[model samples]
Target: MLEFKTTSPEETFAFGQCLAKVLSAGQVVCLVGDLGAGKTLLVQGMAAGLDIQDAINSPTFTILNVYEASFPVYHFDLYRLEDAAELYDIGFYEYTEGDGLSIIEWPDKFPDQLPDEYLWIEINSDFVNNGGKVNERVIRISALGTAYEHICEELKQICPFLP
Candidate 1:
């Protein structure tokens, strides 16, 4: 597992960009975090790193957004999903299994449906009551399979400070 802390949104985004440098096709990244944990911001940085010029945003209502980079990027938001069955309607399996990169938000909602091998990213924010240090976030990343393990290893090289 790799863990790091970011004191501001820019740091988080830069971390994501560093992460994107090691990502390739057929990778699945599952994000777990609260409402304002900067998940989308990280994804935006990843998209930028992948050379995707289009705007990146959470597809809370649409469920999925496909962007074209060197390879396709399948971004999914399961927050609004009322049932796991809805995953079928949104072609979750298809996109995730395709030769593309998949990033999922709220993946904890249906953990059983996720691929056996994926990169799990959990973001925890330290919210101060007095509105001090509001942007502090602790991010933990772990790999579930060999491929993902390699990604984590690459991340360690790119982010030397990761513990």
Candidate 2:
């Protein structure tokens, strides 16, 4: 597990960019966070790191957005999903198991459907630092299996400044 506190959007985004360097296709990153928790900002930075020049926004209505970068990136938002079964209609399984990097926001809503071996990131406001601070977030990252565990280890080595 890796936990870090980011004081601003830029810092969070930078962390995302740093994280992207260690990402590859066929990997899933499940995100758990509340509204306006910088989830989209992190995704934007990841997109930048992947060399995706297009706008990266939360696919709240569309559910998923695909972007071409160093490798394919599939961003998904489950906030609007009324039922977990809705994932099937969007062919969520295919994308999750496909040759693309999948970053999912609000994944805790469908814990049963989440991939068993993936990275899970939980972002929340850091109220302890809320004194006059506009945005501060505590990001916790965990690896579920050997593959993701290796990735987490690599992330720790590459981004030792993530405190």
Candidate 2 wrongly placed segments (more than 4 Å) = 127-133
Residue 17: error of model 1 in Å? 0.4
Q: What lDDT does the true structure give each of the candidates?
A: 0.91, 0.89
lDDT tens digits, residues 42-155, model 1? 899899889899999899988899999999999999999989899999999989999999999999999999998999999988888776555588899999999999998888
89 in model 1: Cα distance from truth in Å? Answer: 0.6
Q: Stretches of candidate 1 above 4 Å error?
A: 129-133, 160-163
Model 2 C-alpha lDDT versus the unseen true structure: 0.89
- Where does candidate 2 clash, by residue pair? none
Q: For residues 1-163, could you state the per-residue lDDT of candidate 2 as single tens digits?
A: 8997888778888989988999999999998887878889989988988889999999999999999987789999999998988999998999999999999999988999988789999988754454644468888999999999998889888774477
List the pairs of residues colliding in candidate 1: none
lDDT: which candidate is best? 1
Q: How many collisions between residues are there in candidate 2?
A: 0
